[model samples]
Every structure is written in structure tokens, then in C-alpha cells.
Target chain A: MDTVHYLLEGFGTALLPINILFAFIGVLIGTAVGVLPGIGPMSGVALLIPVTASMTGGMDPAAAATSSIILLAGVYYGAMYGGSTTSILLNTPGESSSVVTTLDGYQLARQGRAGSALAIAAIGSFCAGIVSLIGLALLAKPLSEVALKFGPAEYFSLMLLGLAAVSGLAGNSMTKAGIMTIFGLLLSTIGLDNVSGVARFTYNIPALYGGLEFLTVAVGLFALGEVFKTILHKESHDGNLAKVGKILPSKQELKESSGPIARGSLLGFFVGVLPGAGATLASFFSYIMEKKISKTPEKFGKGTIAGVAAPESANNAASGGAMIPLLTLGIPGSGTTAILMGALIMYNIQPGPLLFQDHPGVAWGLIASMFIGNVMLLILNMPLVKVFAKIIETPPKYLIPIIIAISVFGVYAVQVNTFDLILLIICGLAGYYLASNDFPLAPLVLGLVLGPMIENNMRRALTASNGDFMVFLEKPISLAFIVIAVLWIVIPFVLKLKGKKVLINEEA
Target chain B: MSKTFDRYASFIFFIVGMAFMIESGRISHSAYGSNVGPNVFPFLLGLILGLLSIKLFIETMKYQNERKEKEALDYKKFLIILVAAILYALLLEPLGYIISTFLFLLVGFQTIEKGGWVKTVLISASFSFGVYYLFAEVLKGTLPGLPAWFSS
Candidate 1:
């Protein structure tokens, strides 16, 4: 009863004319980001943060945070819907999460079923979105209530677990990812100390006192890094796209896909709830699961509607699921969510147990908007699938420069300082070189965002226990978290040692 | 993975970690009633980072026989854009948002593709002026206006 009441109130906030417009723009851009080759949702959300900040500059702070977050979150899920378009039409996935969709989706397109495949993907994503939202609505209050009981020790270990889970699965080598994570953590220590009111590594520089702005690092690493890669590599997305003949799926096509969609949504949602396992992994797992479950598993790669339906549903659901940890536990499950968390912190709104109590409007409104955004996607995607297909041919020449301009503009608009712009460029160079060399950038961003909180919690725990090193081990929840964290890293390393091919989340 | 890059990166990280550990020790240790202070976290992180750097270094040695693939990278284009971007940043405040952005985009578009000057200039101009007017005038957001001398 209480959940229903809160959800209704959320709809009230979501349905406001301005919020609706924000949602529309968010999804529209989100789809474009998804369709475009180089930009993933992480950079998409990062790029939009400053733009949203400037756009909502006129509003009251709380309302402003809510509105901007609404748009950013829209980009996050709307990307899922758009990624399937390229996989089905172009035989090249727009983002890594849609990689599995390409296996059967491309086959279907070759068979002149591109339109149905696209339509099914949209429908599956819609269903998965609803399922994930309902799951989020039902679980939000209870999870936050439980999280409120955590002490500093538990919080410290939990955050450590978050870091470990991400580092383990981010890139090819656990060692490289681990190094990036530590590097990020080290970078986070470059500012004034909060507990002692002392400067640790500022070197008396005015800008260093506030530490490196996460926005600069993010936009530089993701947006600018991507731009530099495109420029240097001469990679272009222009290609022949398969024609989307029909906008509607036939009755049998829908019937065959229904089971996969339902199953994939549930599977993806749960995978999404885990820290570090993102939509790419969720989609991968569901496609494999569907293969195992199907009676005619041989028909999988040759254009089965179930193949397109399942992975598309799973990725969308997983994105929805990823929001759970961020909103309820204050832990971002993926890179995009980490950027989202940083954006929230920028608004002076801490996301955690108290989020529901302190900013119920933001938490609930985001959930309701997701619902409306999904419906809008379903309506907009079916007919516009052909139009979106045309986006594949977008010239890298113009897009590249404009993205750079936006990154510079966005960072400058918010920071209003030259130092940050310089830093942004430096970070861009670092992002390109590091990423090309097998170093994962997500863990580094994660480390930066969670750095202060991790330090604060670790100190609080240490102080509470009279500086005992065993405090983390002494607490049961803390111990469990640390143990799991260790296992997360060790298991992956051991598996690789045994010559087992481990699946890494490249989309991060 | 490039073993050479990893080796250099690890070595640098090793130094960075050592630096952090050494520097954190200089900060006043006890500011509150509890013994734990600002330095402990960084000190611990730095030590672990130093150890990880060593681990990464050794790991790089395992793949010493790795082969290098040669692909033609457009260093000229990249360098030009990089320099242009830095110049754009340097001149942003002095020349204002409109002029610097227009120049950067023009150079960027030209560098990426040589011809269609009319189309390129139009796009570059529209984006620069379009964004400025939309942000500063329409949204009432702040941006550097035309240079004082130029406007006056």
C-alpha cells in the first residue's frame, strides 16, 4: 500500500510538463548516443552532466538536481534500446552490450527480417524496463532500510568490495585493472584532508586544494579519449545498413519471443543488482541461458527471434537493475552509474539509505520517469527505427570536432577556470593512451568517485575501534564483504591462470 | 598489451607510490582524539600501490616475447588537433568563447577532411554561435562574451 502511494506521488513529479520535456530530450539523445559508434552511455551521461547543469541552472537546487538526473538516467536506459538497432540493422553493435544481439540479429537482417528484429528488440526492452522498474520500486524502501543499519566498518568493506568487483571484470588483465584502480585511489588523495583539516598533496596550489574535478577527468577520459581514438585510428562508422522493411512483428514472431523476453528480464535485473557486473555481462548471460533453455537451440545463430529478444531485454533490464545499488546502497555498479553518482554528489545530494527520507521526490521521480521514458521509447522507436538506422552513417569528421567542443564547453561552463580545461586535456591524453594499452578507465573513475567516501569511512571505522587493524575482520558483515572482495579478485586471477577464458565487460 | 608501456607505467607508478608514502608521513599525524589521521590512508594505499607496481613489472616480463603489430597511425592529424585544442584552451578567455570555438572547429573539421570549405565553415560558425547564444542568452547561463576590445 505504501509503495503504491509513493509510486503515485512519483508519477505526479514525473508527469510535470518540464519533466516530460526533459525525459523526451534525454531519451532522444540517449538513442543517438547508442546509435553512434564511438560514444557509449558512460561518455554520453558524462557529456550531458555539464550541459544539464547549465540548463537547469535557473531552477532551485533540489529541483535542479532532480531534473538533471532525470535526463542523465534517461540517456542511460535509452542507450539500451538504441544499441539493438545497429546490431540488427548494421551487423555491428552500437555498444558492447548489444554484441550478443548481433549474433542472431544480423542473421535475421540478412533474412529480410530486420524490421521485425528491431521491433522485437524495442518491445523486449520495453518489457524489461517495466520489469526492472517494478523490481526497483518494490525493493527500494527495504534495501535502504537495511543499508541504514551499516556501521563504518561495514561501509568500508562494502566499498572495498565494490572496487574489487569492478577491477576483477573491467579489462583483460586483472593486474592492469587493479593498477588503474589503485592509481585512481592515489589520485583521489591529492586534495585537502577532510578529517584533520590538513593538506596532504596540494603543494599549496589553489586548484589542487579541491582535488581534481571528477567531471574533467570523466569527460576527458571518455568523450575526449574516444574522440582522439577516432581521429588517430581513422575509424569511421559509415557503412551500408540493412533496410528495415516492416515496423511490426508478426504474431508468431512475438509469440516465440515472449518466453525469452520474460526470462531475460528477470535474469538481467538480478545480474544488474550486483556491483561491477553491468548490462554487457547481463546480456551475455541471458543469451547463453536462452541457448541452454531453447528446444531448437541450433536455430539460434541463424536468425531466431528469441536471440534478439532475450539479449535486448536483458541489457535493458540490467541497466534498470544497476540503478538499484546506486540509489539504495550509494554504490555504483558500473562506470556510467559511477558518473551518475558523481553528478548526484555535485548536487550536494548523497545517494544512500537517507536518500529516500531526505530526497524522496528525486528517488521516486526518477523511477516514474523511467516508466514514462520506456513508453516513449516504445512509441518513438518502432516507426523511427528507419530514421535511427540512418544515424549509422554520421560523419566522424564533424562529429569528432563537435564532441571536443562540447567537452570543452561543458567543462568550462561548470568549472569556469583554465586550470580545469588544461587538466581535462591532460586526462584526455591519459585516457586514450591508457585505454589503448589494455588499462580499464572505469575502475579509475570509480576509484576517484568513491575515494573520499572510502577514506572517510575507513578512518571512521579505525577511530571507532581504537585504531585496531583487525576491526574490519572483527565485524561479521565487514569480514564477509572483505572475504568476498578477495575472492572476487583471486578467483578471476586463478581462472585466467588455468587457461579459462573469462568474459570481461568491455562496455565499461 | 604493450610490455614496454606496462614496464614504463609500472616503474612510474612505483615512484609515484613511493612519493605518496614518503610525503604522507610529513603531514601532522594526530589532529583528533583518535590515533588514525589523514596520513594513514594514503600511506597504506601508496605501499600497496608500490607492491602492485612491482607485481605489474614482473607480469610484464612474463610476456617478453610479445610481437608488435604495425598499423599506420595518423600522428600528424592527431598532433595538429592536440595543439589546436591546447591553443583553444589558452585563448578561450582572451578571445572569448565564440572566436576560439569557431577557430578550433574550423581547424578540426579541416584537419579531419580537407575540402568542402563552405560546408565546413558554415557548420563551424553555426555550432560556435549557436551554442553561445543558446547557453548565454537563451538559458541565461554564463560564458565568455566577445573580447572587450572587439565588442567595444
Candidate 2:
């Protein structure tokens, strides 16, 4: 593709020795934070941003911004690698996105295959990351064109489809998913109502006027929630330290994983590009795809290499895919990308349709750095797997307090609001309970992030159409997405009632 | 145990969602006069969520009827963690970041984890100082300072 040439320019900038080193450091720190369980990319980046900003002294603002972007990407992927280690070793998922990894990952660890599990996760992620980066290089421009064609109705329908797709999140019932999605929309309403400027649910708090903080919700749900859950269970794993079994995949395992990884990457990327759907959905769909296609379908949840490869590959690929909408349009496809959007704003760079013409360096540099950052993550993760897993075993007694304190400090640093600190705790507790009974946190995060955009766009569409009620249905792309959303809700119920168990029968 | 948790949670969701719809309805009176208001979408969403929650509660009961009752939950342990979180939030402002954080870790480790004093103290102290340095010094994040006696 002609666009690949542009990516090469980006690669040149990203490969500069200084940029490479920063990318490596970002991945290393991201992995360490991820291993701690509950510390997500947002908090990870927020804490690190201060240091990066201070140290980038003499670099041009553009190059400095690129460095930070590369660093952030490193943390994003590095967290993925770190998240899996904890999920596999301790059954505690570091992020909501890693929840599915825990189902088979910890089971494999219990079966004395922790080394193999960790190795496959790293290797699978590498393969997926490389392929997705290539896909991004080749596909971004065309995909952006596809994105530009979408009208407000289409965007709204796409979000609805994304919301409905949550019904299939592993372990959550359809109704619970529905309720969770609604809960997210409600949280999104806490700030000012964009059209009227009337406060919907602020209850007089000024912090509430800006609405729920994304970092607060993310840190609380992933990290504090984990802490609360850990304390509740009051259970600790007796370190059996699974005997150093084979770390490398067997030939058969390698053959098995290749098909799953390839398919998962494609499936995950498309799903990731959907508005509001994210890596979590991509992981779910990828797992379902593997089970659907597997010849020996019964080996799925029983420490199967294919099972791990599918979701792991999908999520990494989806990370690349999620960037498409955010970069091409002003639309954010996932919670993480929403945060990335905020970072772009802080750097005074606007990412939208004209971004390519306005600031090609920022766009291309970000895409190019993803490729280098993935490699950096792979190298950073493998050697540190054992050491990282040890941190997971660190007792919560000491761990939780430190994380909570950091979370508080991190929030306070952003706007220096004491109220946000309090809000963080309240939201964290609510998130903890919601997660405990299987209310997936992703939708809430997604809704809160995308809520304003959805509302603003809908109003614009309505006004543009002169109060035509059917304008949402009038656009072709919009209608297609609405139909897809309807199918997402309807199809699953039909499948469940027919006893068409889509879940692969795993070997016990 | 799983079914009980599922059912109870859904029932609570049902009630809260209903409450939200009613509350939105009450506040949306003026918007209703204007034919639409800020609360319109939320009101409808709340109603949909309420209905779904009730349906899910029923489904959870059905599942429970089909399966065996789960073992009793270990609520005692969960309560300790909950209390610790509540305490951390309460004390963070009054006690200052470093001192409160160190004490919070000590209590959680010593009481909840039942770790030894030496282990608890060392871990707690290191963690408090590590975060303080990372955020305050390295990252330039604004953190609450300790009393004059403690800073020296």
C-alpha cells in the first residue's frame, strides 16, 4: 500500500535511538504496574507523564509529543503482557479486559503449565501486534474513508451495536450486560447536559459538574476493585510454583495456535473498530470464533494453547484497530482510546478528519511507534515474567494501600481537586460491588467517555434534519448499524434457547 | 451461593432503576412541558433497565432451582477489606498522604493479612516512601505534605 511508505517515515522517527529507549522504558514500567494488579494504563501514564514532561527539556514540541505518545502506547501493550501474568498466576485480572484470560489461564497454571501459558501469551501477543501494525499501516487510510462516510445516525447505531455486543462478555448474562450498559449511560449523565446546560445528576458538587473522572473509574474498577475483592476473599494462593515445565510451545501447540491467532486478529480488529466496543469485546468474539472453528472443540477451557492465543491475539490486534476511528474521525472506539484523545488535547493536537492534512507528523508518528512499541513490549515482557508474577503474589496487606494512595495522588495531580479524591473512593467501592456479581465495567467506562459525543451528535443530527424523527433511520450506514445492534440483542437469546451451546466443551 | 448473589443483585438493580426513572420523571416536568428534556433518554433507559433487571432476577432463580445451593460465602473476610477501603478514604485527608498511607498498609497487612510486625513495617514504610518519591519528586504530582516533625 502507498500508505506503508508514510509509516516508514513514522518508523524512522520512532526508531531514533532516544525514542526507542523511551518506548522500551514505557513498556517496562507499564508491565511492572500491570503486574501489580488493578493498576491500568491510565493511572500508569498519568503518574509517568509528569516525569516525561519534565525530562523532555530541549526537544521540539512535536518530537516531545511523539515520544510521550510512543511511551503511552508502550504502557498500553505492556499492561496487556503484565495483566496476563497475574490472570494466569493468581486468578486476579489486572484489568477488566484481562478477565477472560483468567478463565483458562489460571486453570493452566493449576495444571502445572504456568510457564507455557506465560510463553504463549507473550508469543501470541507478539504475532498479533506485528500483524495488526501491518494492518494499520496498510488499512488506516481506507478505513478512515469508511469512517468519514458515517453520519451521526450511523455513529449512534454503531454505539448501540457496541452496547448490545456486551451480552456475550464471558461469564455475564445478557440481562446483566444490558443493565450494566444502562448504568454506564446513567453515569455519563452526571455532568452537565450538553444541550440545555442543566445539571442532570451533579447533586451540587462541582466535581460532578465535569462528571465522573475516567482515570478514577478505571483505577478504582481495575485496581481498587481487585483490592476489595482480594480482601473479601481473604484467600491467598499457596505458591505451588508449578515446576519449570516446558516454556516453549510444543510443535503441535504451535500449529494449533497459528490458526487461532490469525483468525482472532482479523475478527478482533473489526470488532475493535466498532464505536464503544473495545478489546474486551474483541477478546470475547475471538474466543467464540476459535471454539466455532476448532476441530477438537472440547479442549478450549482446559489450558488449551489455542484458547489463550485467540483472545490474547485479538486484544492486541484490537488495540491497533481501536485507533482507527479515533484518528480518522473524532470518534473514540474504546475507553483507552478516549483517554488517548484526552492526552492529544493536553498536547494541543486535535485528531479528526483533517488531522492528516493539519498534523501528519502526530498521526503517522503514533502509528509508526505502535510497531516499535510492540516489539519493545515483547522483549520487555518475556524476561520479566517470573519476576512480575512474584509481585502478584505480594500480599494485599502492603500492596492495596500503596496503590490507593498513588491513585489518590494521581487524581489530585491532574486538577488538584480534593473532591475528586473522595469521588475516586466512592466510585471505586461502587465499581467493586458491581464487578463482584458480574457487572462488566467496560460499558460504564465506555458510556462515560462517549456519552457526551453521542448526545451532542444526536442533537446535531436532529437539528440538521429539522426535527425529522426518522433521520437516524434515513442514513444507509446508520441503518445498517442499527440492524446489527438489533441482531446482537436478538441472536444471542435465540441461540441460548435453542440450547445451541456456543461455548466450546473444554477438556477437564 | 452464586445464584443468590445473582438474584439479589438483580433485584436491587430493578428497584434502583425504577427509582431513577421516577426521579427523572419528577425533575423532567418542565422538559415535558417543552415536549422533550435532558431526562428523556435517561428516563426511558431506566425503565428498560428496570424491566430487564426483573427478568434477570427471575432467570437467576430458575438457575438456582436447577442447580445445587452454593457453599456459604465468606462475608467476614470481604467485610474487612471493605472497612479498610472506607477507612483509607476517611483518613486520607486528615492524616496526610504519607503517614495515612503507611498506617493503612500496616493495619491491612497486620490485621487483615496477619503478617508479622517487622514484615509489615518494612513493607509499609517502603511503599509509602516509594509512592511519595514517585509522585511528588519524580512525577511532580502534588501530594499532601506531612507535619514539620515528620518531614525532617
Candidate 3:
């Protein structure tokens, strides 16, 4: 009942003309970028930040915040909507969250059901969006309180658990996953110290003081690196990518997808609310879960609608779910949310236990905008997908160089610092290395954002405890997280040893 | 699987980390509490990285299986992209934002794409101008500039 009242308040703010307009614009641009390969929500937001900042004065600060949140949410869904297009048409996923879609989506394209594949993906995402939003509305406050009780050790332990889970679940050797995670941690340690306020690895260059920007690393590794690797290969195809089939899913497809969509929404919301996790992992887990449960598991990765529906829905739901932690507590559940946190801080609106009480307008207004934005995304993306498809066919030659120019200029524009440009290049090089080695970039990014918080919390905790380490164990919430962390490592190892035969079978 | 690669990564990172530790150690701030200093985290992180490299070395040695050797690293397209990026980085200061970006994008597109001169030029110009107008005029960002002529 309280949730209903708060949400109604949020809706009242969202219904304002300016908020609605921004929500529409956010979904519009989000769909456009989401449809294109090599662009993710992070880049979309980074590219538009300067633009979004321009609109700050036109609306109230609270309303303007809703616009930004709506835009980001739009990008999130737009990316989900557009993700399957490439997977079905080109056998490529625009983002990691879309990888599952590529399996059945590509197969569906091969079977000349491209239109049906896309329609189902869109529909699944819409369902997930609504369900996740409801979950967010209900769970955000309670979870925030839970998040508030965590100290530095608990946060670091949570990160450790995240790294382990990523390695355990990543589609590679455990040793390889461990190495990649460690490598990311090392990367995060670069630049000035967050707690000590001392420069660490600037190498006498002033620009390095800020450390490597995640945007530079992400864009270089995912977008530019992809172009570099694929430039020479001529992907031989048999025909014009399967022409749009029926624009709506068949009754059979709908029946197949309904169950996966529901399960995915629930799973995605839970993952999103957990700190250090995000939509990418949610989608991956949803696909694996669906595959594990399906009666006709063999049909997976071969045009099964459920295979596409599960992950697509999960990823979208996770996007909303992640906001729960970020808004209620100051903790970010994922890397994208971490960036959003940075944006919020830039606006001087600190999000924490008091955020709701201090600024209900910003909190509820942003929440309301997300609800409206999801509808905007569904309406905008489902019909105009062909236009986005055309964007996919755009030659890389034109896009790649422009991307480079923008990245170089964008970093420079922030401060007119020649040194920052150098730092960006160095980060780009590091990104290229990490990508070539199949390291998960998200952990390193999250570490960069959370490192200071963890460090400060540790200092504060120790000061309160007078050097006693037992403070971590004394707190029920922290102890619970520690137990979870311990189980995270042990469960995976035990499962691996016991299921060696199962692993072999899956590999084959 | 080569010692060379592991050694190379470790050696580079170790040197970088040590340099950071030394610099931060000289700073007047503490790291954790009154006893712990700011250099503690960097030094610890560096030490762990060094140890991890040694472990990586041992693991690489255990993989004696003669996997298929990879092709020589392609440095052609990579070089073009790198050079273009370097040029953009270098030229960004003197020429200001719009003109420098437009010229850089033009050359970079042609160098990489090879034959799309007209499309590259137009697209490059439009992209630079659009970013400039959006950031500078619309956003009121203090975008660096030379003269008003570069605006067109």
C-alpha cells in the first residue's frame, strides 16, 4: 500500500509535460543506438551526457533527473530491442546480454523467421520491463536498508564473490577466468589513490592522475577491437538476410515464450538488486536456467523462442532491478549504474538512505520516468526496427573513424586537457589487451567506482573497532555476506569436481 | 605459453606499480588509519600482481600441449588505426576542436576504408559539426575553439 502511494506520487511527477517529452526522446535515441552494433548503453549515455546536461535548465532539477533516468532506461531497453536484430540477421550480439538471443535468433533468421524472432524479443522485453518495474517499486526501499548495513569488508567480500561467480559461470576455463579477473583488479588499482588523495601511477604525466576512464576502455575493447578483428574477413552469406516474416509471433511461439519470460523477469530482478551484478550476467544466467529446465533442451540454440525470450527478458528486468540498489542505497549493482551514480553526484544529488526523505521528488520522479520510458521504448522499437536494421548494414569504415574521433574529442572536451587524451589512449591500449584475453571488463570498472568506498569504509570500520577485525563478523549483515562469499567459492569447486562428467558432456 | 609474454606483462606492471608506490609513499597522507599510509594499497596491489605473474608463468609451463600456432600478429590495419589515433591526439591541441576533429576523421576514414573518399569527407564533416554544435552551442559547454570561421 505504501509502495502504491509512493509510485502514484512518482507517476504524478512523470506525467508532467517536460518529463514525458524527455522520456520520449530518451527512448527514441536509445532505440537508435541500441539497434546499432558496437554501441552499448554506457557509450550511448556518455555520448549524450553533454547533450542531456544542456537540458538541465529547461525543467526543474527533479524533473530533469527523471529525463536523464528515462533516457538511460530507454537506452537500456533500446539496446535490448536492437540486440536481437544483429543476432538474428548477422549472427553477432551488440552487447553481452544479447548473446543468448544470437543462438536461437540467428537460427530463426536462417529458418526465415527473422520477423517473428524480433517480435518475440520485443514482446518478451516489454513483459520483463513491467514485471521488473513492479518488483523495483516494491523491493527498492527494503533492499536499500539492507544495503545500508554493509561495511567495507562486506563490500569487498561482495566484490570477491562477484569475481568468483563470474569466473565460475563464464564460458571458459576457471583458471582463465581467475586470471582475467585479477588482471581487471590490477587495472582498477591504477591512477591516484581514492582514500589517501595521493597520485599513484601518473608517471609524471598530469593526465594519468585520474586513472583510466572506463568509457575509453569499454569503447576501445568492444567497439574498435571488434572492427579491427573483423575488417578483413568477408562473411560469406547465401542470401539477403531472411526478409521480415510475420511481424507478430505465432500462437505457438507465444505459448513457448510465456514461461521463460516470467522466470527470466524474476531472476533478472534478483540479480539486478545484488551489488556487483548486472543485466549481462542476468541474461546469461536466465539462458542457462531455461536450458536446464526445458523439456526439449536439444532444441535450444536452434530457433527455440524460449531461448531468445529468457535472456532478453532477464537482461531488461535486470536493468530495472539494478536501479533499486543504486537509488535506495548508494551502492551500484552494476558498472552502468556506477556511471549513473557518477552522473548523480555530478548533479550534487547524493543517493543514500536519506535520498528518499531529502528529495522524494528526484527519487520518485526518476522511478516514474522509468515506467513511462519502458512503454515509450516498446512503442518506438517494435514497429521501426527495419530502420534500425538499415543502421546495422552501415559500413564500418565510416563508423569506426568517427567513433575514434568522438572518443578523443569527448575526453578532451571535458577539461581541454591534452594530458587526458594521452590517458584515454593508454586506457584504450589496456582495453585492447583485456579484450584479446577474454577478461570480464565489468569487475575492473566496478572496482574503480567502489574501491574508494571500500577503502574508506574499511578505515572507518577499523577506527570504530580500534583495529579489531571482528567488527565484520559482529555485524549480522556483514557476516551473512561473508558466509555467502565462502559458499560462492566452495560450491563452485565442489560442483565442478562432482560434475566433471556433466561438464565434459556440455562441452562436447 | 611463452615465458616471454608472462615476463613482459609482469615486468611492465611491476615497474609501473613500483613507480606509483614510490610516488604515493612520498605523499603526506595515510592509507587506512594513523599507521597505514596511502602507498599501502598500491604497494600491496603491485606485490600481488608480481606474485600472480610468477604463478601464471608456472601454469603456462605446465601446458606443454603443442596447440596450433597462431598467425603472425596483424600490424597493418592496427598500425593505420594507431597512427590515426595518435595524430588525432597530437593535433587536438593546436587546431582546436572542430577543425582538428574534422580533418582527423577525414584522414582516418580514408586511411582505413581506403576508397570511400566522398562519403568519408561528408560524414566526417557532419559528425564533427554536429558534435561541436551540440556540445558547444546547445549544451553551452566550454568547447575549445580557434576562430569563428571553424564554426561553419
> Pairs clashing in candidate 3?
B31-B37, B31-B38
Model 3 lDDT per residue over A1-508, tens place = 8777888988988888877887788777776666666567766665555456555645666656666666656665666667767777777776667877888888888888888888878888888889878887777777666756666667655545544554454433444444545545556556676666666555676656776655455444444444454442322223355566667778998999999999998998888776545777788789999999999999998789888889888988888887876788766655567667656654667776567777777787888778788777677666876777777776666766777776776566554667666656666666556545544444455555555555556666665776576878887767776788677556666877787521210000
Every candidate's lDDT = 0.93, 0.70, 0.67
Clashing pairs in 1: none
Q: How does residue A109 of candidate 2 score in lDDT? A: 83
Query: By summed lDDT, which 10 consecutive residues of candidate 3 chain A come out lowest?
Result: A499-508
lDDT (Cα, 0-100) at B98 in candidate 1: 98
Candidate 2 accuracy as lDDT: 0.70
Q: What is the lDDT, from 0 to 100, of the residue B52 in candidate 3? A: 53
RMSD of each: 1.0, 5.2, 4.2
DockQ class, candidate 1: high
Model 2: fraction of the reference interface contacts it also forms: 0.47
Error of 2 at B143 (Å): 1.7
Q: Whose TM-score is higher: candidate 2's or candidate 3's? A: 3
Name the lDDT value of residue A241 in candidate 3.
53
**DockQ of the two-chain complex in candidate 1:** 0.84
Q: What TM-score would chain B receive for each of the candidates shown?
A: 0.96, 0.76, 0.76
Determine which window of 10 residues in candidate 2 chain A has minimal summed lDDT. A499-508
Query: lDDT: which is higher, 1 or 2?
Result: 1
What are the candidates' individual DockQ scores? 0.84, 0.37, 0.43
